[model samples]
Target: MLERLQAALDNNDAQGFSRELGNIAKLRSMAQLAKDTGLGRESLYKALSGEGNPSFGTILKVIHALGLKLNVQLPERTV
Candidate 1:
């Protein structure tokens, strides 16, 4: 699921990506995401808006808040 979400985000498919993130955030109140992420509600709103730019840490917290984990992977090499 996370992989699919990441693919959507990487592709800049706003609708799909936003839907995924929104579902996760929906688990908690916007205020809760704000408090837990240490970002203001307004900031959180912007960061998750699909057009907003946020630090990697902020993105991580939002993912964590949504019970998701980010895994780092090396890119495949061309032969």
Candidate 2:
């Protein structure tokens, strides 16, 4: 599931990423996630539906709720 999400991201597929995210969210307990993220379950669904543009903060909350870490490794710049 996570791999699928990463693949979507690697491909720069926003809608696919959102769909994958929605799938992952469905696998977990939405009530728990809502409580953890302090977001409504319905709202989570809408945001992760690949239609709505969710805020960065909301994405962060969802990622955190899923117990995943996002690491950033920028490529070295060529002078």
Candidate 3:
């Protein structure tokens, strides 16, 4: 799931990222995820529903709460 989220982010696919987040939220209740991330449950739902624009900070918090971490990698170059 984390890998899928990272792929979405790397591809700059907002909807895909949101979907991955939604999946994660389903595994762990949104209310609990919200409490863990220090965000409002409804707000978190909106953000992960692909309908809300969440800030980078919010994304970071949510990722952390999910026990995931984001890493940077150089894009592969085609020969």
CA lDDT for candidate 3: 0.84
The residue-by-residue lDDT of candidate 2 on 1-79, one tens digit each, is 8899999988888778877888888889888889999999999988899897888798889889999877777878999
Number of the predicted model whose lDDT against the real structure is largest: 2
Report clash pairs, candidate 1: none
Model 3 over residues 1-79: C-alpha lDDT tens digits? 8788878888999878987987898698888888898899988888887778878788888888888777887879999
Name the lDDT of candidate 1: 0.72
Best by TM-score: 2
User: If scored against the real structure, what TM-score would every candidate get?
Assistant: 0.65, 0.86, 0.81
Judging by lDDT, tell me the better candidate of 1 and 2. 2
> Model 3 clash pairs?
none
**Per model, how many backbone clashes are there?**
0, 0, 0
**How far off is residue 70 in model 3, in Å?**
0.5
Decoy 2 TM-score against native: 0.86
The 10-residue segment with the lowest total lDDT in model 3: 49-58
As a whole number from 0 to 100, the lDDT of residue 50 in candidate 2 is 89
Ranking by TM-score: 2, 3, 1
Preferred candidate (TM-score higher): 1 or 2: 2
